[model samples]
Target: MNNYNHILAKSVENGATTLESHLESVADFAVVAARYAGMDTEVALQGALLHDIGKASVVFQKRLRSKPSPLELPFRHEIASLFFLKLVSPDLQPFMIDMIVAHHKSIYKDVSGTGIIDLENEYEEDILQFHLSDFSLWASEAIGILAELKFPGVTHETVITEEDAREAYYFALDHCRKRQKGWSQWKGLLMGADHIASAVGDFKEKVPALFADPDVSFYNRKGELYPLSLIDSDGTKKHTFVKAPTGAGKTDFLIKRCRGRIFYTLPFQASINAMYERILHDLGDHVEDIRLLHSISQLLIGEERITEKVIQDKFGASIKVLTPHQLASIAFGIRGYESVLFDLQGCDIILDEIHTYSDIMQAIVLKMIEVLNHVGCRIHVGTATIPSALEKEILEILGKEQVQYVQLSDEVLTLFNRHEIYKAEAFTDLLPVLQQAVEQEKKILIVCNRVANAQVIFEQIEELYPKTKKMLIHSRFKRGDRNRLEKELKNEYNVSPYACIVVATQVVEVSLDISFDLMITETAPIDALIQRFGRINRKRTAETIGKYKPIYIIAPPQKDPDCLPYNPKILRDSFKVLPDGGELLRETELQSLINQVYPKVEMLNIDLDAVFVDGKWRLKELWHLPKSALIEKLDIDSVVCITQEDDESGKYREADKEERILMEIPVRYSSLRWKRLKQLDIGAHPFVVPDIAYSSERGLDLAKTGAENYDTNYQIW
Candidate 1:
């Protein structure tokens, strides 16, 4: 252990990180995490101690010390670590090997038949020569250090010969082929510990403890009657399912059920943002423990406030509000997934609004659930409405007896009955009704199925009522502008006592807390329609209870094929089950209506059998699949379409590449549209959209024509 201080693991401009210090720090962090996750602490410590043993190579040391390193290709330190596995007991070898080789990258990719193990002819000699150096001193120092640290099963020291290195390499390849099934908790712990130690520059900084006791005084202070508050908080320790109406204190109930760190997942970005703020407001003093994570989290956090602590909070927050898509990486074994698994182990996760997903996404979600279950996560799901078939499938995947199901009472549902259903033929037919509501000074909300339809409706409404306060929102607006508009909509329209109109897309369905006096929406699935209905008369006070607001459902598009975005059969069934004129659409009947519309789970023809083979999950093939494939399968794209005005701005020019990309809007773009934009000569910014095609008022004009006539260099200033 005394001699271990002489060897260096990393070199910076001022000083070096000694091998003994790095190893001890990593082992300390890994042991704590392993104990928390109920893993073998000794095995975790051994793996962490040997994780970077290869960095002691003379060639690697020279490269690290050079001012401007001449080495074109970096050495694989993980591969070098395998040379000394023989010093550990045989029983711990496989676990240690799995953690060593697969810690940084996928083992299947680096050690397969056609992978790095099959070195090219030109590099074969270099690699062989790299490993021929005498590493006996480093080996003896590491073994001595481990003995002092009291690490179990690592007392002996072995001279790493060339043959021993080759044997260990082959053994790792064979282990990856035959023994590796799912992600190893041992690997997750080691990777997590190493990352934290590297980032904090020391292992002494303890992992932040999770927020176990959240403040729920906000709900108690309101003195509001919500069925969820009546339930005991102790029930949250088990796997549970809850069925309750929207605005029925579902968020509070979900939080009360969490006994440790909370992962609250919603379906839409808009919803996640709303939930993040809601939790922050509710938690009050504990606000620092909550974080909002997504692809554009920096944008959501605003550019000026993004510090090192804010970035680190993504993986360490006690309460994380995000989309389930972020967790999909673990199921697919994408890069950096081990750290994610480490964060999720033994955490309490709340899956809110789970029914609003496609068939492919549902399958991926199921796979995630299975993995989370095995990792000791306590899963709690709460939804406004879910079909029986889908519920059955969820319970089967989770094991029926393992989860406790809870449903709200009919009396409480009756209290939430606030909408009166009415059917309309088209937006044209509802013009008179909207004009009348405008005259009565009532707040009106119009939801369209498509962005184009919303734009057209907004234009017509503006022309008809030239003096009314109106706004349009959808998925295509720039992130900054969209966030500003959402805040304005919530503050201005929600609190105003006068008449106003807002036209939007499905983005308004899930977590927005605004209320309207009247709602007009295009026909959608029954569950979705129920969510939409909740936006009207949402408070359900004594005065608003008997004064039921109207929700007009427009007929389906005639020429469109069975509702392009949603299933045609489900839409038709939803329309059939609608209450007649003057009939109250009671919230109690929503569950039955949803079941009627979707009697069976809609299983898409996506092959996921490869993910599960012989009743065991294997991530070998999934790890190799490109991330773009997963994004395409999810029917989402993180596109950054820069408007011509943005290209000329001093702020945009001064911003770094990542900051500029964060400013881009994340919306679904067709291949043809992306290709067309790519072909245009927009100077340095290849993603510039034509001036005539994008604006803050009307986002992303997909149907804009005569693009060749517009000035491509137009600037906002």
Candidate 2:
């Protein structure tokens, strides 16, 4: 053990981290994670201890000692570590092999591939020269350390001859072909442990516990007891489904049903952001237990607390608010999916607002549900409105008898009726209605189907009423601008009660808490329309229960070939069911209207089986595919947009390159749009937009072309 002190695993600015020290740290963390998962801790500890033993090779040390390491090719230390697996018991050989070889990269390459060594071309004769004199000394030291740590059936005399090393390497290659389930768990634990030890600079530091049994009294105290909350959710910890209108205490009910750590998922980033803030505000004392995860998570969490991003990524919080797409990696068996699966095991998950997703996204969500259930998660789904046909499909998948279905009472639903419906020909027809609302000094909300259309209507309103206070909000704005607008809308419209007009796109549909006196929106799917209606007359109190706020529905565009953003058939059906002449819109009739519009599951035209079939195929080939290949297949092209303020303040420019702010734009901007914008880079910054294209008042100008569109294509999906 004394002789082995000369070997180094990593060279630090202060000094070298000895091979023994690094191995011990990794082993300790690995054992902790493995025991928590109810796995074989001894096997995990052994795998981690042996993972970096190859760094003891004389060639590696020589490379490290070089003033600037002259090695041109990447060192294959993981492959070198495979030479010592013979020391482990024969039954545990497979586990050791999988954990060691796949800790940094995939083990199996292809169905016909020979061994892990072939994946790396660093086996030149010159680099194969080992310090044979020191090999026995280092091996004995490792064995002694393992024994000191109370590892069983291993000793200092466990020799590794050339013959034994060759046999062990071949055995590992054969074991990789089996693709055992235990191997995935073992490999994930080892990787997670190594990452944590490296990030914290020591394994001795206390790692935060991933699960907690906190008292949810804070949520319960402020919560209004709804009919759903009264239903007994204490028995059996079974899956639950709630079909209740918005503002009916559904979120509180979902939280009450959880039995363990929670993963609360939403359909959109905006909704997830809002949910994160809501939970943080309600559970302020347990702030460290909750995390917000999304593309712009760093920005959403605030620049001062950016370290939270690293903490959340390495060790997940007890409660996480994120979009379902964050978990899509598991469905595709992409790299790092194992870590996500590990975090979700035995946790309770809440899928809120599940009805507002595209067909493909819905299919992905369904696949996610099946996988989450398979991993022992207790799923609770809450939605304001879902078609009976889709509801039946979800029930059949969850096993109808296994779920506790709860619905708002018909009498309670009657109390939420607060909208009066009106049919208008187009945006032009709604202009007069808008003017009257403004003259009457009432808060107004107008929603358009597309950003282009929203901008057109906003300009028209601005021109017509020059003296009115108005704001335009959509998905195209830079991230910073959107955050400011959200804060402004919450303060001015919600707190002080002002008279103003807000022209927006479908972005206003989900989770935003502001309520308006009037709303005018273009025709969309019934579910989206229901969500839009919720934004108006949101608080269903005695003062607002019987009073019907007008919600004008404009007819679908006449000459457009594709209704787009929404199905034409669904729009026509939705329009046909609208109450004429501003009739009182009862919440009790909401589900019935949705059933009429989406009578059968096929109406959505989603290929629900496609994701499942693909997932199964990927699982079969999981061992064979490299992570890089998997990531390339799942890559979605996106850009990051920074405002002039962000760029000039050095908040995003002068900070650590990795700590820059990322404001993800909406996904509607296609790759073609990005190409066009990139061509117009105006030299101030390669990606920064021209001054004329963006404004604090109007947001990103989608109508701007050429140089004006320079950095506007920053939409992230």
Candidate 1, 281-364: lDDT as tens digits: 778465455677764455555443344233343344678888888888766666667678778977888998788887778777
Each model's lDDT: 0.71, 0.69
Residue lDDT tens for model 2, 1-717: 334567787765434877777788888778777777789988988888888777766556676777534445445566567777877888988788767876666554533242364442334333333323355545555555555555566666556776666677667656665664431666677777777666555424444554554445555534232555556565664898998888887888888788777889987666777788888888757645677776456565655455555555564467888877778766656556666777777788899888788765676677778778777888998999998877777776677778878887788788777888999887777777887888788899999887778888888878987887788887677666677777677778655454688888877788888889899999998899999998898876656756778899998876556586677888899888878798988888888888999887563332332223422433532243333332233223244444444554545555543344433233333423553443213222224444456676676664553343334443321
lDDT minimum window of 10 residues, candidate 1: 677-686
Decoy 2 TM-score against native: 0.83
- Model 2 per-residue lDDT at 652: 54
Total backbone collisions, model 2? 0
| TM-score for all models, in order of appearance | 0.83, 0.83
Evaluate model 2: give its lDDT: 0.69
Off by over 4 Å in 2: 1-28, 53-75, 109-164, 180-183, 197-207, 217-225, 302-307, 464-468, 603-618, 621-637, 642-653, 657-659, 662-669, 672-692, 702-717
